[model samples]
Target: MELRKSGSAVWSPASDWRRGSTVRWLLLSVGLGWISLFDSTLWSQTKEVVLPRGTDVSVMKKDILLFEKILDVKLSHIPNAMLAVVDRTKGVYLKGYGIVLTFLVNINRVVITTPFGERPVGKRQTAEEKRRRIHEIREMLIQALKDNPGSFKQLTPSDAVVIVAHFEDSNELDDAKRHKTIVLKVFKRDLDVYKTNGYEKFKQQVVIDEY
Candidate 1:
């Protein structure tokens, strides 16, 4: 008896299995998208603490006035400053991005005469001097971080920390990136991308602009 050739095998089972897997994957992707949207909305609802410019009204005005007087120049002459906060459960540590004015003081000059001795101090620094001093202070700030490891700790996932990095000029951004470990290592809560505004805008809001 002649046996008829077997008809071509039907791969229906394999095709159906693949189709089922594709459907499941699509559903999973949609579910993840919804979850991501919800998370984004929740994050937006949380309060944000802007820095430097966000200080108390009275304190901001006072600082502007003080800087103007000490610099002996218009607020426009002063470079913009940034502020960052290292948030911990106990308290927050704040640092300003501007130069350390204390180091600019003249140690050689005599400021006051006392019965016991004389107090030597320096006069207010010029804009040029302040600019130069910023680089020096940056090194010291980095060194301090290296020396004091306990001062900075890793941030928890829930922690909301803001790091404000002030650049002396636009070119400094590259330098800051080169030495990010010193300048931005403590900012573990977020990535190194900074949201910044112009010094002119900041001056308009806070500076008196008048002599």
Candidate 2:
């Protein structure tokens, strides 16, 4: 694979990379066009980043790590037992390729451990409770997206950012992955509003899909 800096100059690992880092540069197969080869393991590891055609390897990798750092700091809070993005970020492919990123936030205990107390969520969710939880998580994700133009630089105008809040239980696995959750997505074009406009306008510009 050929690497290029943001200046579009060729990047040499020995000259460019700092120490204590690992490279998972997207493999570019000769004569294979722009196809990405992936098995289960690669998919699991790389799902956080949704790459577009002509993606910048050096810039994208650096910016992905930056987005991850933001996610770490912004969502690094424990209420009662906890509130976090599970272990790591996860994503799914759309019908198209390299157009999405879905981050799973563990909101199981987050919904329960509240200022009032553990309000029952999951299957017992009333419409109001569901709305409240969804809105709360959406706002939190909005906060997570703030002031980071780097995060969206690698994404195309057609690509998007998706945040999923999984209402997971402490021990139960199925409920954790399947039972209750909220998914919010916005196009990177819309997300880039923060760069030109301010946070207030950008927040309103983001469309919260199903909490």
Candidate 3:
């Protein structure tokens, strides 16, 4: 009796014809298109800049001024502990980004309002807890200076001073990175101070507190 030939014996089409290759190409194209359409917008609105240890205070002041001029805003009430931007053009200040500060004089502790994202110094039992923390930090700094009047001098003559910069970029974009890219070009002179004093010394002083 004649039996049907095994299906395996039947001729098959080319491997390429069995499945569509365009599926892979289509997926790749769609992925690339999605990536191209992705928005690079910043996630946060206000950016905080705790200046690096090696920044020269004098130069930093100038940089702040220049930044203000470019942005057309006047920042007042600058403090070592915190600074909140108050736009000269507009009267009201935004609370989320503004800093509350209590300036100390003559080694006495002064309490200031604490802004969000600030680390507390001690047990933060209440809303006032944050204010006390800032006051404590200031008090500690005052005490440190009192304990060693020469502490300020411990900073090598060339050691850089720190500065904080605030930008209106609410999205807290990498404005500092972008700003540094341009500022460094114009303020190349400060770069020499770093090379001479060395960032290692500055970093050590910041950590060790040994002047």
Best by lDDT: 2
Candidate 1, residue 109: how far the Cα is off, in Å: 7.4
TM-scores, all candidates, are 0.23, 0.49, 0.18
Give the Cα lDDT of each candidate: 0.35, 0.57, 0.31
Using lDDT, rank the candidates from best to worst. 2, 1, 3
* Model 1 lDDT tens row, 1-211: 3334347634565666888999999999999999999998888776463533333445534443343243322212323211111111122334442212211222112244579786544454454754465444344333332333222233232222222223222122355432221122333222212213333332222211110
Per-residue error for 67 in candidate 1, Å, reads 27
lDDT of 3 by residue, 1-211 (tens): 3234466553335434444567778889999887766632231322444543553455534443443332222122223223223232111111222211111211111323367654433221332543454344433433222232221222334433222222222223365521210010101223333334544432233322210
The per-prediction CA RMSD against the true structure, in angstroms, equals 19.5, 23.6, 22.0
What is the TM-score (0 to 1) of candidate 3? 0.18
Q: Measured by C-alpha RMSD in angstroms, how accurate is candidate 3?
A: 22.0
Candidate 3 pairs with clashing backbones: 44-171, 45-170, 45-171
Off by over 4 Å in 1: 1-119, 122-125, 146-150, 157-186, 189-211
User: Which of 1 and 2 is the better model by lDDT?
Assistant: 2
